[model samples]
Target: MTTNLILTNSLDEIAEFVTLLVIFIIVIGITYFSIRIVGNIQKEKLGRGNIQILETQKVSNTKYIQIVRIGKKCFAIAICKDSISYLCEVDEGDLQFNTDSSISKSSAESFKTIIDKFKKDKPED
Candidate 1:
């Protein structure tokens, strides 16, 4: 009878250990997945903020160009039927043009219109 009791006790201990290990593994998996979800949420928030900034700063005209500025640098991005082109910097004091030949006249006109509107709407600093 004593030998039988010892064997039963050992089996119970092993079962308890396995249960604890399984619980620990589950907890760790949940923690890892939680961190990943939170990180993705933060990245999406940052991307949305950037898009809002771009939309608010965009200028569009029917006959001329559209312009958007990324931070301090200005870009004269033109939109055509199936292509996009970057013309020249419309910012004052710097007359730089893109060396790439892919830029079209329609794009230049659109960029010029956007820059002109931005200049007009800018508040004095």
Candidate 2:
């Protein structure tokens, strides 16, 4: 009788642990997705602003050269921790833009290939 009671108690504890774990996972998933949705919404809202940073190249840990678009014109600017200095006005014709489809395809293919390689290299348990 004692042995049976211990076994029952152990099973109950395991079931409770599993239930809590599942709930925790669901809450985490909800939070993750909610944050992502909010981030995308905020990006869309902020992206409509007149000032846009088109490109940035790092010169040092705290200094960068950036191409910025304000209104209809684009400018190259030097950005540091303390100040921003205008470098030059950029002609619209000089800019090369990557198409969304090409960028996404390349990124997806690279990521998938990396994961496939990792899985292939890993030994099965």
Q: Please give, for residues 1-125, the per-residue lDDT of candidate 1 as tens digits.
A: 99999999999999999999999999999999998899789767865642211211123542234454566666666665566677766573454445443242334355667779999999989
TM-score of candidate 1 relative to the true fold = 0.41
- RMSD list, candidates in order: 17.5, 5.8
Sequence-dependent TM-score of model 2: 0.71
Candidate 2 — which residues are off by over 4 angstroms?
Answer: 96-125
Candidate 2 on 1-125: residue-level lDDT in tens? Answer: 99999999999999999999999999999999999899789778876899877766779999988888899999999999999999999997898866553332333355667779999999999
Q: In candidate 1, residue 27 scores what lDDT? A: 100
Candidates' lDDT values, in order? 0.62, 0.83
> Model 1 Cα displacement at 30 (Å)?
0.9
